[model samples]
Target: MGEKTLEEISKAMRDIDITMLSTYAANGAIASRPMSNNRDVDYEGDSYFFTWENAHMVGEIENNQNVSLSYQGHKHFLIAAEGKAQVIRDKHAFKEHWNADLDKWFENGIDTPGVVMIRVDATRLHYWDGMDEGEIVLS
Candidate 1:
């Protein structure tokens, strides 16, 4: 009904494993793709995703850190977040967030060539669920 804290929003987002990450392409068109959260949804106003350094998404982020993430869940629950994205290439940092499932994508694990982690530090998050709607600002 009213505003919710970061914890409450985080709880609601925990079940959401995938988010549509949106960025601006070289042509200035909006490009979006599904990004797995790896069940690391302890949302502390930040989110992380894994991708190859050579991916188009990585290039998009390099051109513009401004990005958005959209989440959809059961019962029509929805969330949208705007943030600045940072590309991380450190193996140690990647190790912290890496999981076994990622092996399916990177056979050599975090050491896989060009492996990179995208960290989004959200500045604002807005949510809606039928009659309940609110926003959280982290910046």
Candidate 2:
């Protein structure tokens, strides 16, 4: 099989719901948290999930682009990427990724202050599917 591209990775992301988000601090400490998809294919270019502008996870990415997002369904997979993340104060990107439930935190909906968008550029993938009795082939 040919190696997967970013679009392929983004498409594969549609197979799962939740993903583990990994970030780091200046001290080299790594942190991981469970994040939900705002929509089924939220990892796409317009994927929208909300985070406080002051969150440590947000700070780490701003400081360093090295990060990872992993998801598991009938198989396990991880996407390792490096990309800078800055607060997307623009209302357009926010609106594109916006979800109504976000109003709980952002009273103004997509116009809520301190809401940001994380733009991640995926670079690598380590994945394996062990959901069967043995190696099986399909045609």
Candidate 3:
């Protein structure tokens, strides 16, 4: 097993629906929660997730933009991404990443009140497939 490229790692992540989003809490502790990408796994060193504006994670992100995302796929494939997160309240941006599956969470879709989107732009990506491991640093 040799080093894996971003495209190859992205392909492996296509089926991974959920990622553990980690943020820094106000108390200086690390907080983590499972956030579904809603199948928006196009890679490109960026990931998006929708949540309410009042959510704790939102505040955490506001306090510290540095965040991490962990993904696990079949066949012992695992990926970890370190990035900076931005909270987006723009409805147009929401619509861009919106999908039918998200309707279950946001009843009014992008029109839902207080809805915000978190965009994590990965600066570093590390992947491990069984005994093989590699890392990619995005510019």
Residue 14 displacement (Å), model 1 = 1.3
Q: TM-score per candidate, in order? A: 0.96, 0.70, 0.97
- CA lDDT, every model vs. true structure: 0.93, 0.61, 0.93
Candidate 2 wrongly placed segments (more than 4 Å): 1-12, 40-48, 75-86, 131-139
Expressed as tens digits, the lDDT of each residue in 1-139 for candidate 2 is: 3354446556767776677778888899989887766654734333334677888888887788677766676455544333334456677877766767667778988666777777554444544444322111211
- Which of the two candidates, 1 or 2, achieves a greater TM-score against the reference? 1
Prediction 1 TM-score vs. true = 0.96
lDDT of model 1 at residue 101? 95
Report the C-alpha lDDT of model 3 over 4-97, residue by residue, as the tens digit: 8888988888899999999999999999999999888777998999999999999999999999999999989899999999999999998889
- Counting clashing residue pairs in each candidate, in order, gives 0, 0, 0
> What's the CA RMSD of model 3 in angstroms?
1.0
Return the lDDT, model 1, position 115.
91
**For every candidate structure, what is the RMSD over all alpha carbons to the true structure, in angstroms?**
1.0, 5.9, 1.0
Candidate 3: where are CA atoms >4 Å away? none
Of 2 and 3, the candidate ranking higher by TM-score: 3
lDDT of 1 by residue, 3-116 (tens): 878898899898999999999999999999999999888888889999998899999999999999999988988999999999999999998899999999999999899899
Worst 10 residues of 1 by lDDT: 1-10
How many clashing pairs in candidate 2? 0
